[model samples]
Target: MIRIKRAYEEVKESDGFRILIDRLWPRGVSKEKLKIDLWLKEIAPSSELRKSFGHDPNRWEEFQSKYRDELKEKSELLIQIKKLEEKLGNISLIYSAKDEKHDNAVVLLELLNN
Candidate 1:
């Protein structure tokens, strides 16, 4: 199973194979506190796409489309994530967006589901 979690949330044992998908390290969230298994920077949206979206709600739809395109070019990383999912049996993608429902993790969950 796959899940998404906020970096600010307390780490839980249920969050097996925790992976931080954000391109940048979450500000103020210490490594010791996170205890993630992987940081999949390559699986995140490109720096250019991230700046273009700017986490603007108005651009959420466009952001999803553009980010999906970015992800399509990253099948190698996606395969790795899939392998981890199978091996670990559970996975949680951690992100730092203030708007949880409108974040890259949400988009990634949607993409992975389909």
Candidate 2:
């Protein structure tokens, strides 16, 4: 199974094989505190796209659409996520965004489950 989590959330044993999917590290979060197994920055949205969206709810739809298009070029990274899920049973895609419902991780969770 695939799950999405905020980088600042408390770590849990059930959050298996945690992967930090943000292109940039969460501000003020230390490596030890994050407890991530992998930092898959390449799986994150491009800097241009992220800047364009700016986490505005009004822009979420457009962001998701454009992000999905960008994801098409990241087939290998997507496959890598799948492999981790299969091997780990429960993998979490971690992000630093404050808007939980409108983040790239949300889009990725939907895509992976489908």
Candidate 3:
């Protein structure tokens, strides 16, 4: 199973294989504070795309399309994530976006589902 959680949230015991998928480290969050099992920056959207979207809801559709395209070329990272998913009971993708509905994690979750 795959899950999404805000980076600001406390790392709960229930969260298995917590992974940070953002290309950049979340502002104000210390590495030690984030109990992440993996930091899969390669699986994140490209810097160009991330800057372009800027978390704008209006760019959500475009962002998803572009991100999916990027993922197609990231077979190694995708396979790593898939292996982690199979090894762990559950996988939680942690991100720092304020608008949960308009973030890359949403697209990543969808990709993992398929």
What TM-score number comes out for model 2?
A: 0.98
Tens digit of per-residue lDDT, candidate 2, span 1-114? 899999999999999999999999999999999999999999899999999999999999999999999999998999999998887799999999999899999999998888
* Local accuracy of candidate 3 as per-residue lDDT tens digits, 15-108: 8889999988899988889987889888889899999999999999999999999999998887888898898879999999999899999998
* Candidate 2 residue runs with Cα over 4 Å from true position: none
Model 1 over residues 1-114: C-alpha lDDT tens digits? 999999999999999999999999999989999998899988888899899999999999999999989888988887888888888899999999999878899989987877
Which stretches of model 1 miss by more than 4 angstroms?
A: none
Flag clash pairs in model 1: none
Q: What order do you get sorting by TM-score, best first?
A: 2, 1, 3
Order the numbered candidates by lDDT, best leading: 2, 1, 3
Residue 21, model 2: lDDT of 93
Best-fitting candidate, scored by TM-score: 2
For each candidate, give its TM-score against the true structure. Answer: 0.96, 0.98, 0.95
Q: By how many angstroms RMSD does model 2 differ from the true structure?
A: 0.6
**Local lDDT at 61 for model 2:** 93
> Which portions of model 3 show Cα errors greater than 4 Å?
none
TM-score of 3: 0.95
